[model samples]
Target: MLVALRKIIRHFKGDEDGVALVEVAMVTPFVLLLAAGVFEFSNMLNTRMLLDAGVKDAARYMARCSSDWDTCSGYAKNLAVNGAISGGSARVTGWTTGEVTVSKSLSTPAIDSGTGTELYLSSTANVDVVQVSTSYPYAGVGFWSYLGFGQISLSVFHQERVLGW
Candidate 1:
């Protein structure tokens, strides 16, 4: 029995049947990391697209005056929650109004009716990006500083021309 067991052990030691499996085990971790990176990249890209669309939608809402700073902010916030946009918080900024000047109108018949006035208004929403301080749980290692795992910020801008009501 001892002789048979020693033979079996020697056979396994010299066997190359599982060489491919050994190689696979060596490479599997790298392959999995690459796949995970690709998935993360796709997610980031999708988030960016959603952010753009949300900004444009909020801009349209603002143009109609159906939404104000608070409403726009709320809409942006909801969008973030709904995956229409990403980040943490939304803020209203770059709110402005301008007057449009144009000459000639339907009322003018072969005559100059002077300049026509129209109101132009726009607003922007800013979203606070997920900060590393909030998102990434820091380990007790000082290597985080060397790795530059720190603050990150991102925001979106939206603008639209207001239509005269």
Candidate 2:
């Protein structure tokens, strides 16, 4: 039995099956990093797109001089943030209407482009997403979080101008 076991071990030692193990070891980290980056990047992009839509919608209401209370700039800001994150908490940092200079060289600017024919409305929002600290959970796994690679901050800038005269 001992001789048979020794032969089995020797066979595995020289076998090509171990090559797969080595390849996996070499590529696993890269694959994991790519996955994590994709997840993070997608989340950020989705948030930005949502914010841009919100800001444009808000600007639209402002351009119309809508006084429907539900369609005001404040409402637009709230809509922009809440729509992006369904159940998350988001705060509107600033919602201001300003007179943007329209360059004479340019023809009639598009309405939804945020540069209105006469005025422009801009909205800025910052969002904080609660990310779990990887300190205690993954510490035993030898992955360190001291590299400043854990947290994510989200910000958005949206602008629009009304098409109405």
Candidate 3:
């Protein structure tokens, strides 16, 4: 019985059939985490780009119609929330009117000293400025959320000189 037990132990120790399975098991978690990170990052980046494009379009539209405050406000609000000229084109979820801000002023300083300064309007001689801004909360998906990383706040702002109607 002792000799049989020793032979069984030696056979089990020399077996290589489970090596691939062990390696895969060890690497699977890291691969899954990497894939999840890439997916979440890509989604966040796409959302930001969409917000930027929408904000710029909204700003330009408002600037062209600065004289009509009501129209500009409505158009900007719709564009910010929906990412389209008309309604019902919202690319990101959980957007609200409060997240979109539209304002006009003669002073360029106000526009310069606001969030999203990278898209600030160029100063023109005697032209009014219109600024449009939108904010979004990006909650990480998949493994990101599971790792205790919280939501990220993103915003886009664009300013353009009002073209007299």
Candidate 4:
């Protein structure tokens, strides 16, 4: 039995016929995992970019509008979610107006908080800044959980200098 096992081992050592196949079989899972990682990373990057752009756009819109604070904030949230103040398709799947948060600073424009309803402050901590933020749960191709990375939430915000009209 020992001699037979040695013969099998020696045969395998000299047999180069399936060497490439064996190497590929050994490395395929790792290569596949690498590819999946790249794909998932790209998706996350794209989602993050969309979130940033949306928040920035919303902040810009909010900064210029001198309308009612609640109304303006609503429009800003709509714009952030739909890319249009009026209405449009959401930038990301499962994204809604609920995820969007539009807020204003209290000390910006050197105005008093008691001035009027037009400047109803939403965040005193972010004074001198107009903030648009959102938190979206990233819905990947489900490979993240398979890889033991349960879930990911893309939380993003953009602040703009207060320049209200």
Best by TM-score: 4
Clash list (residue pairs), candidate 4? none
Tens-digit per-residue lDDT, 1-165, candidate 1: 999999999889977898999999999988976776566556545554555554555445444434354544454445433423344343222111111011111222222235533222223222112110011122222323454645333344544444422
Candidate 2 wrong stretches, greater than 4 Å:
1-15, 68-71, 83-146, 150-153, 163-165
As a whole number from 0 to 100, the lDDT of residue 81 in candidate 2 is 47
Clashes of each: 0, 2, 0, 0
The candidates, ranked best first by lDDT, are 4, 3, 2, 1
Clashes of 4: 0
Clashing pairs in 3: none
Candidate 2 at residue 48, lDDT?
49
lDDT of 1 at 16: 88
Deviation in Å, model 2, residue 74 alpha carbon: 2.3
Evaluate all candidate structures by whole-model CA lDDT and list the values in order: 0.41, 0.42, 0.76, 0.82
Segments of candidate 1 deviating more than 4 angstroms: 1-15, 66-151
lDDT of 3 by residue, 1-165 (tens): 999999999989978888999999999999988888888899889989988877888788887763468776887788767876576667677777678888886855524444745334455434467788887888656567777888789889988877755
lDDT of 4 by residue, 27-145 (tens): 99999989988998998999899888899999999988888889889999989888999878888778888999888765654335476444334444334678889998887757768
- Angstrom error at residue 146, model 4: 2.6
